[model samples]
Target: MNYQWYPGHMTKAKRMMQEDIKLIDLVIELVDARVPLSSRNPDIDELGKNKARLILLNKADLASDECNALWMAYFKTKGYFTVKVNSRNGSGIKAVEGAIQEACKEKIERDRRRGIKNRPVRAMVVGIPNVGKSTFINTFAGKACAKTGNKPGVTKGKQWIRLNKNTELLDTPGILWPKFEDQTVGLHLAMIGSIRDEILNVDELALELIKFLKEHYQGCLEERYGCSESGDVVSVLGEIAESRAGRLKGNELDYTKAAAILIDDFRIGRLGKITLEFP
Candidate 1:
């Protein structure tokens, strides 16, 4: 499948981050725990060079704990300060401040050498759209400081939110690269709702999801929808439609509704804690 989701605002957002990165002491990047590598915009490595980096595996509560551990180890080996967090409920937010200080310890020490005291660390939160950047900002700030939406492109501008005298956060709009060279990266983004649903064929995406689940997480379909897991993707979707009472005007199974339900259930963790990619 071919997938593309680039908005005009993202172009402007990328330019803005280029300028904002110069003013920050750290870059706190959020990535979906389920597809950590796929959800990240590779351009950030160049954009945030020489900056203290923290990678928060946001929405971690919905991903498999085993995968989360592997991802944390993967990022740590790459020298990034990493943490697992459920940003919506503020489960791991408290550790963020200490991690910030630790990640920027070199910068902090330089400030102390130059006789600088009590200067708050300036940080900017960045991620691909819908990866919970705004939600992480709000939970970290202890207030609804950043506007959030379930869909991509909810935040269109930059705002600096002060968490305390010791730290300040710049909340910028989420961004994606100009193009996805690998179709698998695009597919992962689409599965996790990082891309808009309107531009996608929900049934085809659901089929891809079903195929992945059957291969990687055997028996999930049978456990959730009471359908045999051995059939083709469409037949499994049809089973889901029948189980969920989805029907059309002519009494045909409503595959569209069933597809949407299946995707939603997976997104919100109704199926179970699942991880799409492993390190």
Candidate 2:
């Protein structure tokens, strides 16, 4: 249950986001699909008020398809245009361009009424670190896209990637820190490998993961580690140790190493397409 956050970097990130929020017409947020809520910091609601919002459930490849759909509905209920996307492999990415236009249709109409023709929608991609923001940007703004440098009246130095005739995305993504105040939220983020593993007690985290998978995602451990369908969690760890050859010099089961390997398996989708938090 040990979680460490860098407070100084968080404050600076907030300040930078506040400044960036003022110049954009829309916010395209990226979040891990496996742990949607826990992977997010909703303070963007305050920072991005009065701007259009679109949520991209990044890394959809690592999460269950049904869970990803439920999460899309969940965010839609909260007034966001949401879509499941796997930025790494480009699944569901085509839907994003259309979703962007739909999310900003109102603003585009307003500009049209003012006689501003072909003014591309200005947007910024934002997310917690390691949530595929960079990958999304690289793919969305392809090689043909041009980088629009700083303006005269604008901030000292700003970069914008011109996506198309109708859109321009700010190059620098707004870095938002995850809200670690909730202990469960911290645990979910840690399980996804978003937070460094060194900061957590691997044995305790593995036990927590075992309890969750046993209750909600039954058979995942057995499928991944050849677990014998045991009711005892420690025995499950032993099975994993046996399958993965986790052993001490005395040939004793190394539960700690076994636990670390199990967590990594789940994180990397070897265990299964499991959702840490259900909708």
Candidate 3:
């Protein structure tokens, strides 16, 4: 299945961000830890040119710790201040303030040289949909400053939130580009719940996920659902359906239900600390 999701609202959001980019000192981009590169919107680079950049790998609890460390090093090599954070439980949230200060140290020094003091650093938080921008903001600010939801597009417009005397945050809606040049990017995004499930063929996606686990994570499927993973992916999925009691009206196995369960399990990290991409 070809995965592409760009609603009309994203166009407006991108335009608004372009206008607001001039007002901020830093761009704090949040990316899914499982599929860091794919979850990032390329438009952000163009919009945030010449701005201080900090990449927060959200949902770090669900991704492999080894891969997370590698990804942090990878982004740091590219000159982006990177942090591995689990926004839900507040694990790595404390390091963000210092990272932000470090990222904008040059700007801070310039302001100091000009005798401008006590000026708060304005930052714009950006990321693709469902990458946990709102949750990160809420957690970082120590209050429910932005609307939080599990689904994408929770923040509809820009809201400037004053966190403290030294910093302020501008929350923008999540936006994806119009087209994905690499279908693998789309597939990885879909698997990580960045794309809406309503428009996707979950069964097909589940098969693709199973294939990936079989190749990279070897006994994941067998251990999770108690299903044999030696056969073809379809047969593996069938075994999963049987093991999970996904049955329909006539007592036949329901692949759709089974697929939904498997996908949800992966999203919630039931299958273990799995990362879809490597540095």
The residue-by-residue lDDT of candidate 3 on 1-279, one tens digit each, is 888877566677777777777778999999999999998888888788889999999999999999999999999999899999999999999999999899999999999999999887888888877888878887898764443222233234556677777788875533445357789999998998878899899999999999999999999999999998899999999999998856889988988889999999999999999999999
Tens digits of per-residue lDDT, candidate 2, 13-66, equal 888898888888999989899999888786888889799999999988889989
Q: What is the C-alpha local distance difference test score of each model? A: 0.86, 0.85, 0.86
Q: Candidate 3: which pairs clash?
A: none
TM-score of 3: 0.91
- List the candidates' TM-scores in order: 0.91, 0.96, 0.91
Model 2: lDDT equals 0.85
lDDT of 1 by residue, 39-77 (tens): 887888888988999999999999999999999999999
Model 3 lDDT, residue 122, Cα: 84
Over 4 Å off, model 1: 144-159, 172-178
Question: Which candidate, 2 or 3, would have the higher lDDT against the true structure?
Answer: 3
In model 2, how large is the Cα lDDT of residue 234? 80
Per-candidate RMSD, Å: 5.0, 1.3, 4.9
